[model samples]
Target chain A: MTREILAVALLAGFGLATGSVAAGPAEDLKVYQAYFEQHFPDFTPEDYTRGMYNFSQDKRAQYEAIMEFPPYEMAVEEGQELFATPFANGNSYSNCFENAGIGIAQTYPRFDAERGKVMTLGMAINDCRVQNGEEPLDVVKGPLVYIEAYMSEAARGKAIDITVPDDPRALAAYEEGKRIYFTRRGPRAFACYHCHWEAAGARIRGNELSPARGQAANFPAYRSKWGEMGSIQRRFKGCMEEFGAKPLKPGGEDMANLEYFHRRLSNGIPLNAPNNRF
Target chain B: MPYPMISKNVALAAVFTVMHVVTLPLMAQEGKGASAAATGNGPEAAVEQGKAKAIELCQGCHQFKGADQAGTVGPPLLAMKARFPDPAKLRALIYDAQKASKPYTMMPPFGRNGLVSEQDIEHIIAFLYTL
Candidate 1:
């Protein structure tokens, strides 16, 4: 009995030693999220995930009326068709991912331990295409967005459960993403943190800026501006373009890392993808 | 046949050359107002236009006075003379603020991306001098 007790203590110590190695987030993720909540004291945490729609009562009413028939339904139907169809090599996307790609959107933008990088769901889809001897779709729009839309619809209401493991590389990635979020880029020199974090509820060009927390949960949302389905990557590119900065490629390391940092903030929020928005 | 192909290539080159020559002077003429911004003493530009323009462009990120002073993103336009001793430096900073400050500043470059012209920046400086 004493030997067993000694062994258990050693095992517990080992576990703690390993856990401490990663050092966790440099800044508390909870504190970062709280910054947003503190800024908009009127808004409950739930209202922010839907973006600018819930910013004002008048706007919410207008958006709610619009939501009766979300504009991106056609894209969802088109995506369902595309997802069901087989690839050129007689293999389909089902062969690449688990559970035939249903409800898998919430688990993505995950850090692949072997590759030592974040793997966005969009990148995984493209990977399946390339592996099956087909040309990969562009990350921004068209087929990729369509497929993502369908996947997001499938994963609707699933809690965002992205795992940022306590690994040095993962911690480093989160740090890098945090830097990108806060650091200003190029001649149109404003960081995303300045607009989104500092000016969380401020209006810019008919749009109320949302806080960074929980915004990542709903991707492939139906944007009225686009008149179709759009993904997080497409929105990110648009933000950079507005500031006159050269936007990063969709599914690239920086974007995936950015998603990683974001998913941490909305760690358990239910996905409301295929969502309607202005 | 060879002569005809040569003439086609030459004509294409000539067209491009003409475009370059025509565009050069036009660009210089456009930059003429920008150079005058160095002095901030151009007779053609007016101060009132600048005051209105300052409220529209800068009010989003900076506080001016009682009127459009809601912005807290940037530093308040206070003690304008000491903060920027040289009016030209102020113009350069407004033109391309990233160059004037450290590696990371929240101030957006109104001048560099041509979002705001130098002449417009000149008017903004005039308005700021009042503060």
Candidate 2:
């Protein structure tokens, strides 16, 4: 065969082979952990859970002062109150999760072979509400962020430990999440990695970008820009629109899978949710 | 394997060629964007516009300040006056930088992919000239 045709044949064969060979979760975790460890050499794996403040010393100082009078503390108190209050059926979020749903944020966004999809903590809380005949809460703000903030606060210092089941569906969901994280789209054609990975420490106007590490640990975070509490899902939509791209639905499979993949990337980092930021 | 990310490396040769070829013919009569920077006295308005775009887009990679300091992605644009003094070459370079630089330069083809308009690129070049 000619050189050109031979090259095409080889590429096609390689593509087919790549499609068939799915890597295991442990392998994925190993590579992802080493990536952040190498990039942010200054911070320990747990330090990433500290969020943007984990970078510069000045930023850290500012973050500490802000934390001294954290604005998100009230939300946690309110969430605890809401968590215990019985619904019309006298059922609470406690019925849906183990250990009364306290300190379990690390084990969430898990692959459920029975559901054939991933299940995030927010989704589980909403499921409990629905089962109790209560209207489901929105994942963006209000009670959703409040409750997640409370759960994350309770689970603070719990190491993130998501497990990608051996099932093909679980692996496929992870691959899809990885694809979304890397795919460039919209008017700007900027992917998540474009800013977070390739240009992690660079400044955009007044805003300094954060690296993708330790992000999952401090979610349901407070941003002074918004003057209120928000979830990682909220930030994803904001980032997408900022790049002049349309965002996916808030609690859809895409969002959950993306969360799962990101959390896994920061695996073993302590969960320190409800953190305040700029 | 996870350091640089596999997704980034998935950029195939075919995709790059398709984008560069499709966007090259867009070259047309000059817009006011590039000239504003060269003239020096053109209203600071156009320069500001260009600066805004650069701050939003390119600053993530290329530092426009002294010695092209900061940033780890692309080379510094601090010396654009001598490096890419010609407007046409600058425009072409920004449009499909990877193609102009090499087959695998990590710079995104902002022009070819419509990430930034031609007028905007001229404005970015105008801002680059000031640096």
Which candidate tops lDDT? 2
Q: Show the colliding residue pairs in model 1.
A: none
Candidate 1's TM-score: 0.72
Counting only residues 3 or more apart in sequence or on different chains, how many pairs clash (N, Cα, C under 3 Å) in candidate 2? 0
How far is A152's C-alpha from truth in model 2 (Å)? Answer: 1.2
The local lDDT score (0 to 100) that residue A91 gets in candidate 1 is 90
True contacts kept of each: 0.29, 0.12
| Residues A1-278, model 1: lDDT tens digits | 23223222223243443345543463456555556656667765466666666566788899888878887677788888888789988898889888888998888777888878887888888888899898988877788888888888888888877777878787678767755665566566677766776566666535567777768876777777887667788888888888778887777889888767766677667877777777
Position A146, candidate 2: lDDT: 91
lDDT of each: 0.68, 0.71
| Per-chain TM-score, chain A, candidate 1 | 0.84
- Clash pairs, candidate 2, are none
User: At residue A163, what lDDT does model 2 achieve?
Assistant: 87
Task: Please list the residue runs of candidate 2 whose C-alpha ends up more than 4 Å from where it truly belongs after superposition.
Answer: A1-22, B1-57, B65-73, B85-89, B101-108, B119-131
